[model samples]
Target chain A: MFETLSNVFTDNPLIVSFAIIGITMYIAYKLSDKLTRGRIHGSAIAIILGLVLAYLGGVLTGGEKGLSDISIFAGIGLMGGGMLRDFAIVATAFGASFDEIKKAGMSGVSALFIGVLLSYVVGVAVALSFGYTDAVSLTTIGGGTATYIVGPVTGAAIGASSEVITISIAAGLVKSILTMIGTPFVAKYIGLNNPRSAMVYGGLMGTTSGVAGGLAATDPKLVPYGAVTATFYTGLGCLMVPSVLFLMTRAIFG
Target chain B: MVIFGVALLAICMLIGIFFGEILGLFLGVEANVGGVGIAMIMLVLIVDYLKKRGKLSLPAQDGLGFWSAMYIPIVIAMSANQNVAGALDGGPLAIMAGVAAALIGWLFVPLLSKGGLQTEETVEENTFIGGENKNVRNIK
Candidate 1:
C-alpha cells in the first residue's frame, strides 16, 4: 500500500494531490475537536497540494524530456512541497504556537545580523592589509549557510552578496541557525526548563526540523503551503509535516 | 519577518539543490518544497499580516482559529488550479518574481502593523498543543 501510494504520487503527483485534497477536505469536515482539526486540515492541504504539483510536473517529467520539460513545474513542485509543509505546521500551530515560534524565530534574525557583521569586519581588516578594495564579497562568500538562509534581502540590504551564490548561502545558513536556535527556545519555553530536560524537547524539535527541512527542501508541490507557514503563521504543523511524511511513507508503502 | 522568510526560501532552495536530493533519498520520502512559496507569500502579504498579532506573548488559544484563516486562501487557490504552480504563475507577475517582492514587504510590514491601534487587547491563550486541547478532535 505504501509503496503503491508513493509510486502513484511519484508517478503522478498532481493526481495524488487532488486525491489527497479530496480526502483531506472530507477529513477536515468530519474532524471533531479543534486540535485534531488543525492537524488533519493542515497536513491535508500540504499532502494534497504536493500531489497536485508533482502530478502536473509529472506531465513534464514523465514525458520524453524528463526534468527540463518539467523543470518549471519541477521547480514549482519542489518548492511547493516545502511551502505546504510549513503552512501545515504554522496553521496547525495556529495563534498560540505561532507566536511562540515567532518569538523564537527572531534568534535567526540575530544570528543573521551577527554573521554578516563579523564576516565583513574580518573581511575588511584582511583586505586593507592585502591592499585590495573589492572586499565586499567578504560578506558574499563569507555569508555561508546562515546568510543564505536569511536570503539576499539582508545580503543585498547590507550589500553582503549581490551575486546569487553568496546571497543563497547567507540565507540558508541563517535559517539553519534559526532552526537550531528555535529548538532550545521551544524546549525552555514549552515547560522543560531544565537544560537536560529541555535538550530532550530541543533535540526532538531540532531533529524534526532537520527531517522537515529536508522533505520541504526537496518537494516543490508543497512549496505553497511552506510559503504559508514561513510567511505568516505558527509552525504547529512543523512536527506534523515530518510525521505525516513518515505516515505517508508508511501508508503508501506498508 | 517577511525578510527572514525570503532568506529562508533562498537558503532552502540552495539546500534543496545540494543536500535535498541526498536527504530525500535516504529518507525514502519526497523532501521537495523547502519554503520558497511561503517566502513568496510573505513577500506578498508582509510578515505583520502573515502572523497573528502578538500581544502579551503569554500564549494564544486561537491556534485552531489561525489554521482556519490560513486554510481558506490556500484551499481555494489549490482547487482553482489543477497545478499549483500554474495557478500561482497565472496570478500577478509580482508573485512569479518571488524574492524581489518579499523585499518590498519586509521594508514596509512594520508600517502596516503599526497603522492599527498600538495597545493590544488581552485574548485567551492556548499554552499546550494536544496537552491542553485534548478536547479538540480532527475535522474528519
Candidate 2:
C-alpha cells in the first residue's frame, strides 16, 4: 500500500507538489495561530518551511534546483516559477482603487524613492564592508536590500556573478524576516494606525510581505493601505535598481 | 461572471507582457520589464472604469477581489522561495549581507518613525497609530 502510494505521487508530480504546498500552508497557519498567536502571518511561516524543504531537497538530491532536482518533487519548480510569480503580482493589483491611491499624495510617492534609496545605500555599504569591490557585486547586493526581487533582477540584468546575486537575495530575505518580526512591536510607537500612515510606512518599508504581515498583526484594517504602496515600492525598485542605480555603482566602483 | 473577469485579466496580462518585452528589448535587458506591474495598472484602471460605468455588478467585483486576494498570498510565497538554495551555498559573505541588512533596517525604523510621531498634533486626521480609535473602522 505504501509503495503504491509513493509510486502514485512519483508518477504525478504536480499533484504531489500541490499536496506538499497545501500541507505546508495548513501547518504554517496552525503554527501561526497556536504558537505565535497570529502575530506572524501563516504565509511567512510557509515560506520559511518551503526554504527548509528546498534545502533538504538540495541535500537529498545533491542538485542545484533544490526539490525540483528530485524526480518526484519536480513539479515544485514549475509551480513556483517566474510565470506564476508575475501572474500573482498582476492579480494582486486588481484590488487597488485609484481614489484610495490618490489619497496618499506626494508623501507616499516620495516614501517609495526614499525607501529604495536608503536600503540600496545600506546594502552597498554592507557589500563593501564584506570586501566586495566590483560594481556588479555591489549593485546587485544593494538592489537586494531594496527587495529580493530587485536584487536578482538587477544582477541578471548587469551580468553579476551568481554568488553575488545569491548574497543579494540573502540580504533581502533578512530584511523581510526582520520587518515581519519587528513591525508589530514598534507599530504603537510609530503611529502606524491610520491609512495615510500605513501607506507611507509601506512606501518606506518596501517589502510587500513584511509590511503586509507586520501591519496585519498591528491592524488588519491597515493591511490594504500598506500593501498598495509596498507594491509600488517593488515596482519602483525594479525600475531603478538595474538602470540608474547600477550605472551609479559602476561609475563609483569602476 | 468569473469567466469575464478572468478574460479581462488575461487581456491586461497579454498587453502588459507585450509592452514589457518591448521595454526589455529597448533597454537591452534579457528579462521581462515590469510586465506584472503594467498588467496590474491596466487591471486597476479597467476595473475602476467598469465600476463607475455600471458595467460591473457587485458579485463580479467581489469575484475579482477574491481572486486578487487569493493570488497575493501565493505570490508572496513564490517570491520568498526564489534562490534560497543559491544563497545558502554562497558562503559567509552572503550570510553577512543578510544579517547586516536586517540589523540596519531595524535600527533605521526609529529615525523613519520620528517624522511620523512628531506630527501627532495634526487635527485633520484624528486617528493615531498605537491605540484603537473609532475612525479606524472607517478605512477600507
Which is the leading candidate under DockQ?
2
Docking class of 1: incorrect
- Where model 2 places Cα greater than 4 Å from the true spot, the runs are A1-4, A10-14, A62-69, A134-136, A147-166, A169-254, B26-33, B72-80, B103-140
The worst-scoring run of ten residues by lDDT in candidate 1 chain A lies at A232-241
Candidate 1 chain B — worst ten consecutive residues by lDDT sum?
B115-124
Q: DockQ (Cα-based) per candidate?
A: 0.06, 0.26
The digit string of per-residue lDDT tens for model 2 on A174-204 reads: 6765576567667766677555677778778
| Interface quality of candidate 2 as DockQ | 0.26
Error of 1 at B45 (Å): 20
Looking at candidate 1, what is the lDDT of residue B99?
Answer: 25
Of the true contacts between chains A and B, what fraction does model 2 have?
A: 0.28
